[model samples]
Target: MKNEIRVIGGRFRSRKLRFPDAPGLRPTPDRVRETLFNWLRNDIEGARCLDLYAGSGALGFEAASRGASKVVQVEQDAAVCRALERNRALLNAEAVEIVQVEVRRFLAGEGQPFDLVFLDPPFRQGLVVPCCGALEENGWLSSSAKIYLEAEREFRLDGLPLNWRPLRGGKAGEVGYHLCERTFFR
Candidate 1:
């Protein structure tokens, strides 16, 4: 994410923070971030947010900026985690926590629930299904939690766990947001 840090839409607009040139770091696009934050603006405030595969801490820091009570980020890549930490500090977002761990392991180890969880694994990784299931088993999500899932537009989600239901999705260039909510099965 060598590109300059750009705030989607808020007080930090046009502010360029340091974004290291790293391969594992693909910051979510501003247009998509803007739409996501807009859709979540009301609920995001005061929410306990979790960001999985938080490369550059974009989503997590954004949550903090928008008034989330606390934001926890998980990223497996060491360099990416470092970048995330730097970005968090640059944004002056002290309410964010960055944990260097694989998405699966973190979900498997989670001991508490979050109000909102953002899961944006790399493209073609097929992480959503197992991650959600692991989250449930590990007590990482509130029963009423909302999960924002993202993937490549062409990725077919035929095997996702029964708990998730697609809410809103649209392609922005090559990436897509597959917003899903926890739903009852049986």
Candidate 2:
């Protein structure tokens, strides 16, 4: 069976996007998304975004809906990629691009700097830290970029980049969500 998620705010508010029931595919809950967007309200418009491990493309699509100039969604699963493409077409999201590739591979290649990033890798796979590092080291993040991360509630924040300061964070049941800002000290 397929599942659906709605865009909470912006031009596509209330529109629903469908996703396949693939293993390890957990979309960010609406409440958490609302809070994350609120934290980013001042910075989201016209920002370039990267949704790493874009399982359901919820975060990426939401960014586009809220006026992000560019949003790149990277997913490794073929089925999920198809679903994301369908959603993009359904919404006529010309600013949103769906890339079918592993998050690591996508990060390895050079890319334009992003003003915002969403990092919500699969639970229990230990992909978050390395992905954060790659974003920082591989030139994916612009200076002072904002990153939103979701993980198991018990996950620690010690692995995050040293320059990334926690701007806001909280837990919802088993999920931990955080919004961080990169502080360049040079």
Superposed model 2: Cα runs more than 4 Å off: none
Clash pairs for candidate 2 = none
Task: TM-score each candidate.
Answer: 0.89, 0.97
Model 1 TM:
0.89
lDDT agreement of model 1 with the native: 0.77
Error of 2 at 172 (Å): 0.6
Worst-scoring 10-residue span by lDDT in model 1: 9-18
lDDT of 1 by residue, 1-186 (tens): 366667665555566665566654677888888888887877788899999988767788778887888999988888777877877777778778989987887776736978899988888777767887787668877777778877787866577667777777778887878667667632
Question: What TM-score does model 2 achieve against the real structure?
Answer: 0.97
Candidate with the greatest lDDT versus the true structure: 2
